[model samples]
Target: MRWLLLIWLILWGTGVEVRAQAMSRPKNLILMIADGCGPASITMARDYARAVLGRKELALDAIQVGAVRTGSVSSRVTDSAASATAYACGVKTYNGAIAVDTAGRPLATLLEAAKARGMATGLVVTSRITHATPAAFVAHVPRRAMESEIAVQMLDQRVDVLLGGGWAYFLPAAEGGRRADHRNLLREAEKAGYQVVRTAADFRNGVRRPVLGLFGPDHLPYEIDRNPQAVPSLAEMTRTAIALLKEDPEGFFLMVEGSRIDHAGHANDAAAHVLEVLAYDEAVAVALDFARRDGQTLVVSVADHEAGGLSLGRNVDGRGIYDWRPEVLARVQASHERLIPALRQSDRPDSLLRAWLGLDSLRAEEQALVRQATVKPDRWPVVLTELIGRRAVVGWTTNGHTAVDVNLYAFGPGAERLVGSFENDELGRLLAELMGFDLSSLTTTLRQQQPVGESR
Candidate 1:
């Protein structure tokens, strides 16, 4: 009986490779990263979307599998650098390093491996391309602080498509930055067989080869504040990157990160966070639309962690808190741009009138009371920060990072392999297997046991 079971497991239907073999490796890999996303963050976004759409959103509804664990390599607690490293290099390293081992040894990123396998590679993010999360995939450093140096690493890797910000890191230090490089990355990339494009028009005009685009000096503008006439929305960025990468016949790996979602949450600005989340969801919709039509592509969406400890401050059902009308949320967000800016610059009620908001602008005396509004935040259901989220019916737990299990959503071929709980590092391994690269080929060893998410 034991031999029969072993035979079934090892040689089932000879034509079909069971276990890791049955599913054909992904020809195209689209990894959607929500920088500071956790289950709570996703749940909050989902509920917010449901209220406005009056139904399950197609972006999240395509989720066929969800995971429960998201720990970094060194400890139960993790930061973006460590977390991103987990996914960038299958083997886990210290908390602040990227694509390196615990002994401070640098390892090859999935992008480098994919490129070696004759696959095209691309990176897209709302954050700077040199940011820790994006850097993990192509840059090896002992510390994430080497962001500028890491920019050179990305350049050195010769990734087919590089989009996002961090131009400051690539420019000479005299230009108001710490970077030591004087070489123009865009020009260098072009010289090294990459076409450099910086505007929407660049994407509009089709290109015949790999392209490198830098849209901003640091991280790209937050989705809420980005001028549509200038920077492309997250969805547009995703769609354009896809079109470019898909042209490669050897298949491609594209990493699109919705970075500012976490940035907004980190600021404890609820309204901003909601907008960022929406922007990311729109990008997800773009990816799914492509995958659904392509049939051969595999799309995986997950977060590195959760930010601002976001959770409902007031239980809507328990406290009679009702969902904010979508229009109301939109108005609030627009209003705050003018309102909050003044609020941040003010100290008391005496200057309350300073707010450009049409609301009863507080007089000097009123400003005094308004300034006090931030007090006793723990006792109240709202605050200036909460006001941001409340307009969208979004709430938060605190204004800092927390240990939590982020979400994992997947679709298309090979997605079934992600149906169960796994660690953050395993995600890297899974991608390795899905891409037809033997995990060992990268020359990294990862624990076989799955890492569990904080939520579980």
Candidate 2:
């Protein structure tokens, strides 16, 4: 036995055996997207988790193999739709494209290919199920805003598990929904044998295969504003999706998105951003735990782009020194979305000022800014964001996405494919290869196909 072990070690050490071992395919793939979570955003979240939440380390920090360039075909800074398309379809499309090439032609996505090869496919997101990120995986459209059409395509694709918000898109106009066609997609989904779940209870109780869960009318509430009784956490949705998809012996492909991290970043709300990242990290923990136990799964976590150009440390006292106050961030009780509505509803801004700011005492100037924000409906978010950033020691360059390379973290079988720097589109090709799919054939077939309204 000792001699056999020695021979195995020798073989492993040799370049020949190492190459073969590294080429091994993963039976299952879990692609987790922390939308707009860049390096600085991650640093702020990590520090806050350690200082305030008492966490020793984040699951994401453990498996960070390297960074990946996130440029789209149309722009250096990519949007959620285009980046997701690149990750899902092995091609770089325009910013608004969803599972389509730059010419508006449909592209066979990773989930479609996985399903074609007898693998169970699932999508779990904190955003609308038909939103850009998740839509890119299974739906082909010229624009990401065609979510109602995306919902139809989702059903057409026969995805095994569909979970997240966007209930409005599924319901018809007659049912007080945003759909223009008056077609009740929820009924159509039910007729097609999906166990549709709407609330937290339904999600927990409806544990069967072919489950469809839409928790909110739009994107689910931010983690800081979420009610546990009404909505499920990202971690909960991840576990449920894994449970359903893993039952397939042929293996599975699942995409989970921490969708609202981008929104909080856009708002430049540092407290809310950290909370969303922590929520995303919890989902990461779930995936890592499952991958470790399954051993045949490849778990990859990445970001689409960097939003807000977030900087962790702010200049303090005009002394050229930077500082971050985790305690100030810890005092935040609600998200900007929640606080804004409350401010609008309440006539007494002065009484609710300090509590809403989450600070024990606010400077006179800060108090004056908050008072002005409450009265000035147009400048409310900007002023509040500034107040939050000043107190928490966070700084933002812009309230939009930035052209920055995002970090990539991977573990388990085929994790080697994710290491080192590469274009965002290359990730899709690597993932296709990892799943043992012929990318050349898939691309050729998809390109040959024309758009819905285009004449051949």
Candidate 3:
């Protein structure tokens, strides 16, 4: 066994292709996407894990193969919609396109192809089930903002397992949903033979096919603010999805996303970002464990794009600080978004910060900033993050996506196919090849089934 492993490593390092006959195609595929995680994000998480949690390394540390270039057809930086579409369809499209080509024509995605081949398919995410990354796999709309339409199409696809938030998009306005179309998709889902679940308890108890688990009305709570009793964590959802999908004899395809790491990055909250990445790593561990046990499974984890331009070391007041303090972030108990609301309602806002941020005492300037932001609601998050970030010695260049390349990790069968740096679309094509799915033929058939000029 050691000799065979050494031979495999030698072949991989030397760029010598092993014959197809010598390799077995994976019977199951698990694709995990960290929506806006980047190299710096991983470093921050690792530092926190080692310094505070006393862990040696992350689950992803052992399986990292290479990096992936994240750019869209329209710009060097990519958004969730186009970047996810690149992975789902193996094609480049505009920034807002969802599983559509640059021409606004619907394209077949890997999930669709897997379903066509009689495999069970599932999507698990921390974002709304109708959000960009997950939507790219099961629904094709011209715009990512058309979440109502996206929700309709997801049910039409009949994905075996659907787990996430965005229950509002599935119901009508009269029924406390955001939809103006007056369609109760929850009822529609029930009529279609789906077991709709809404709480962590119900989700755990469920053992049926075609399960739709919407734990919240919008995106699920950030890990810093998550209630384990009310909402299932990303790892829990991934474990459940695997349990349901692996029952299929033909094979299965599942996409699991750590959706809100991007949200924390956009807020430039180092404390929140650290917790989100740790949550995502936990989910990665779940996938890796299942893959290790089920040798016929292929597990690939990658980020679509980097967000916030996160920097580990920061220069303070013209003084070059050569150190970062992850211990400061370890003291944070809630996300800044959660604190903003508390700030708005509390008359003694300083007391709120003292309790939640573990700040026993604040400097005069820090107290003043909180007072000013207390009066001005718009600056609430700004002051909160500023206080935390300065202590942590972390900085962010921009509150948006960056063109920087992101790391890729893979394990299980055919992981060798993704061992080198490449474009995001190229990675998509490789994924299809590893699964032995003809994406080009699938796309052609989809185009023929629906006329090119039809509404997307």
Q: What CA root-mean-square deviation does each model show from the true structure?
A: 6.5, 4.0, 4.7
lDDT at 453, model 3? 45
Candidate 2 ranges beyond 4 A from true positions? 1-23, 316-320, 447-456
lDDT of 1 by residue, 290-391 (tens): 999998898999888888877654454346465444433444433333345555555552334233222334445434445456453231223455334433
lDDT of 2 at 106: 84
lDDT of 3 at 271: 88
lDDT of 2 by residue, 1-456 (tens): 999999988977797765865557889999999999999989888898889889888889999998889888889989999999989988888999988887777888889888878999999999988999999998888999998889888888889998899999988888978899899999998999989889999787766889899999999999988999999999999999999999899999999999999999999888889889999999999999999999999999999999998987766445433678777888878888888777777787656656866677778878778778777866678877777777777888888999999999999988876889878889889989888887567757766664453422
What overall lDDT, based on C-alpha atoms, would model 3 receive against the true structure? Answer: 0.91
1 against 3, candidate with superior lDDT: 3
**Alpha-carbon error at 227 in model 2, in Å?**
0.7
Q: lDDT tens string, model 3, 5-117?
A: 99989988666445562365899999999989999999999999999999999999999999999899999999999999999989888898999999988889999999999
In each prediction, how many residue pairs overlap at the backbone (N, C-alpha, C within less than 3 A)? 15, 0, 0
In model 3, how large is the Cα lDDT of residue 44?
97
Please provide TM-scores, in order, for all candidate models, with all chains considered together.
0.83, 0.93, 0.94
The global C-alpha lDDT for each of the candidates, from Candidate 1 onward, is 0.71, 0.87, 0.91
Best by TM-score: 3
lDDT score, residue 21, model 1?
Answer: 62
* Model 1: lDDT of residue 418: 88
